[model samples]
Target: MFFRIINRIQPCTSQQRLLSRSPALQNSLLQQFFDDEENFGKQELRAKKRPGRSWTNEELRLKSSEDLHKLWYVCLKERNMLLTMEKAHKATARHFPNPERLDRVKGTLKNIEEVVHERNDAYYQLETGDSASAPKRTVTSFMGFTYEKRAEEHYSPPGEGQKGYEVPYLDDDAYLMQKLWNEKELCKERDRKDNLARRQLANDEMKHYKRGGRRTFDRLEDLKVYQ
Candidate 1:
């Protein structure tokens, strides 16, 4: 699979071929995915000596919206390319080249999304005097733990008009499970306590033996008690 991509992918050479045959075909999705600039050839199968560094938050913040948008897509495309390469390598049971490129591209995409979110929030607050982030609520989960649930648009408040989803109450089966778990824990605690008491008794016997000489001690009986 890796070799197949390498053999067929000629980047600019392929684009030129397409241009000569039909200029309209150059704007195809396949051409877009098989971008012409980067190493669409076999060279990409080998690890890079040193790849470009990840985009910094400060650098991303300075870019205009349009420029940032374009950069985001470029990063996205690079990520897709890396993932495809990785899949091909894995399918052939080989190691992917330049694994760090995945992390770098992922980080860049995260930074881009964060910057965009900040900008959107600022704009939303300026215009509407409210936070732009999704509305979330603290709700209990089925396991009896609090979870942050993002509220979705509904006809009415949850659990009022509709059977709005709520953290489920423990049923008979759940109660039985909980009881069994508690019993198991209690048994463990009892066992641990008994073990500790036996250890203390054994230590005391050892102290007795140390105080009295070895000849005065009943070594076999003491060992039996400890065991």
Candidate 2:
């Protein structure tokens, strides 16, 4: 298990040696918070066996829920270890090597999370005809940016004795202002798209031009190609 890690770290000058800890310190329960003591002050770290890619969604989908649960903790632990090692490297002013391994661990964890969510959604759809995710509604801010407002749990309804909570509504003047703002924003978006299209068409026309700023044509008949 440790051989892979041991192989990655190369010793170098200028950094303090990491092997002087007492044997009794090995029994400390918090040792997991740091990398293996031998790993500190290493010059470089490379993954053993060199996993070329992160876990795939298709592969993860085939695993049972229990397997996914275990895999999540495994990735989480590796992430924590890698981060701890990174901090140590920074403290010693050493370059943290093979940083992509940390990204790989994180990607695996994300894939596992998405896979679990997909399974939960499918199960909820089969049983209740709705997704397992929180309900959200789109709301436009006063500044005209759109955002999804997620539903939150509350012990009591939002009325009567609830002084802090109330339904949100825009006043008439604000409503009309926002409506005008939205229309202007929509027009701006359409113009932006039209501008992009016009630019792309111009680029296409100029791409084949020669050094003299004229496109090649075998004969006058070939000019009809553009038409």
Best by lDDT: 2
* TM-scores of the models, in the order given: 0.54, 0.61
In model 1, which regions exceed 4 Å deviation?
1-49, 141-144, 155-227
Tell me the TM-score of model 2: 0.61
Predictions in order: lDDT:
0.66, 0.67
* Angstrom error at residue 212, model 1: 26
The residue-by-residue lDDT of candidate 2 on 155-226, one tens digit each, is 977778433322267667657887898899999998887656545445544756622233677799855434
What lDDT does candidate 2 reach at residue 85? 72
lDDT score of residue 178 within candidate 1: 68
Per-residue CA lDDT of model 1 for 1-227, tens digit only, reads 33454333333576435333443234566444443334433344334444688998899999999999999999998888678756655655555555787899999999999999999999999999866888787665444444678867778665754432455576666567767878899999988876765666555667777653233445677554333
Find the candidate with the highest TM-score and give its number: 2
Question: For model 2, where is the 10-residue window of minimal lDDT?
Answer: 13-22
- Model 1 has a clash total of 0
